[model samples]
Target chain A: MMSKIVRTMASFLILFVLIYGLYIIMHGHSTPGGGFQGGAVVASGVALLIVAFGSHSIHRSLLERRLSILISIGLLIFIGLAFGGMAKTFFYNFLVGSPIFGHIPPSGPNPGEMSSGGVIPIMDIGVGLNVAGGLSAILLVMALATTVMEVEE
Target chain B: MRKIAIAVSLSIFIGFLIATAFLIHPFGYPPSEMDDYIIENTQSETGANNAVTAVIFDYRGFDTLGEATILFTAVTGVVMLFRAKKKREK
Candidate 1:
């Protein structure tokens, strides 16, 4: 376990990092950042948490098995969205003028509506989830393996 | 002899890096017709305010697919490698 100061700082900052990361992912259709960058940011927060709380406790508390499931679900969401536009063509932006994420964006530079961007936002979400799960899983696995090696030694 | 060869290779590597840096296009002045076309048509074509997102999830979706595939493959490989092994009674 980390010191109280470290833990407190981590607990305080983790939420902000997570919220900022989600903001980046959700606003990806209008902002500079997108899914992968946001995901990495969130994963960095997770790494911070791991460092603060130690991996074993986190592993026990947070079901490590569910991470793989999350990864699968993310991939499914992405591929499913891709197939959702199959009526016209593969990855066709068919929802570009419909009710579901189909609000027409204003031409030229302007503050964009969240409801706009067709399937881009959804795809961003999918990629964000996939990256967050994959990166965190990799980090958790490495930490756990190192602990096990230490026990063996 | 070995010291001279190491110095020669290090200088060559630095020279290559310097040449590439000088040869690169000026900052913020990339000359590409494709970029202009994408920027002009992103909103109308894909209904996305962010051209980068439209490019990733619409214009170049196949590239995103490949990226997703690579991530999935990596996760699967890591899980398989570090999974717990059961012990057999002797």
Candidate 2:
């Protein structure tokens, strides 16, 4: 078992990391960070938690099965969004200037628009989910395998 | 003779590194006309304030798709490799 202080610090840090990552992903189309960076940050937070608490506790709480599902869902959302713009092109920017996420700004550096960038935000979300699940699964699988190997020995 | 050979190889490596450094363009001034075009047209085209994101998710979406495919494959491979452990645990 880990120390109480270590666990408490990890718990506190994880929340901030998650929120920052989500912010990066959400503001991807209007800021510096994008899906990959945000997802990596969030996955690192998960890694920190796992390291603090050990893999077994994490394994019981967050199943690999669920992560696989998340990866699949994220990929499906991306592909579906791509197909959504098939009427014009495969991955068309059809949503730009429409109601949804299609608010065109005045063609200069402005305040920022949440509902702009059309399909970019959706793609960012999909990619972010895919990366987070994939990376966390990799880390968990490695941890779980090592524990199993030790048990065998 | 061994020491001489190591010295020669190290000098050659250093020479190559120096040559590469000399060949590289000065910092902050990349000769990219495409960048100027993208910066100019990104707002109207994609409507996203961040041109980088616009390029990643819109202009070059195929690239993102390829990246997603690579991640999916990696995760699948890892899970498959560890499936035996899961079965054993069960």
For candidate 1, the C-alpha RMSD (Å) to the true structure equals: 2.9
| lDDT by residue (tens digit), candidate 2, A103-136 | 7888786873453788888889999999999999
lDDT of 2 by residue, B1-90 (tens): 999999999999999999988899887888989989999999899988898898888888999999999999999999898997678778
- Give candidate 1 misplaced runs (Cα > 4 Å): A112-115, B1-28, B84-90
lDDT value, candidate 2, whole model: 0.90
Across residues B1-90, which tens digit of lDDT does each residue of candidate 1 receive? 999999999999999999998899988888989999999999888887778889999999999999999998998887677774312211
* Top-lDDT candidate index: 2
Candidate 2: stretches off by over 4 Å: A112-115, B1-21, B85-90
* Per-model tally of clashing residue pairs: 0, 0
Error of 1 at B30 (Å): 2.6
lDDT (Cα, tens digit) per residue for candidate 1, span A14-131: 9999999999998898878889999889888989989999989889876558987878888898999999999998998877888866777678767635537888888899999999
Q: What lDDT does candidate 2 reach at residue A137?
A: 95
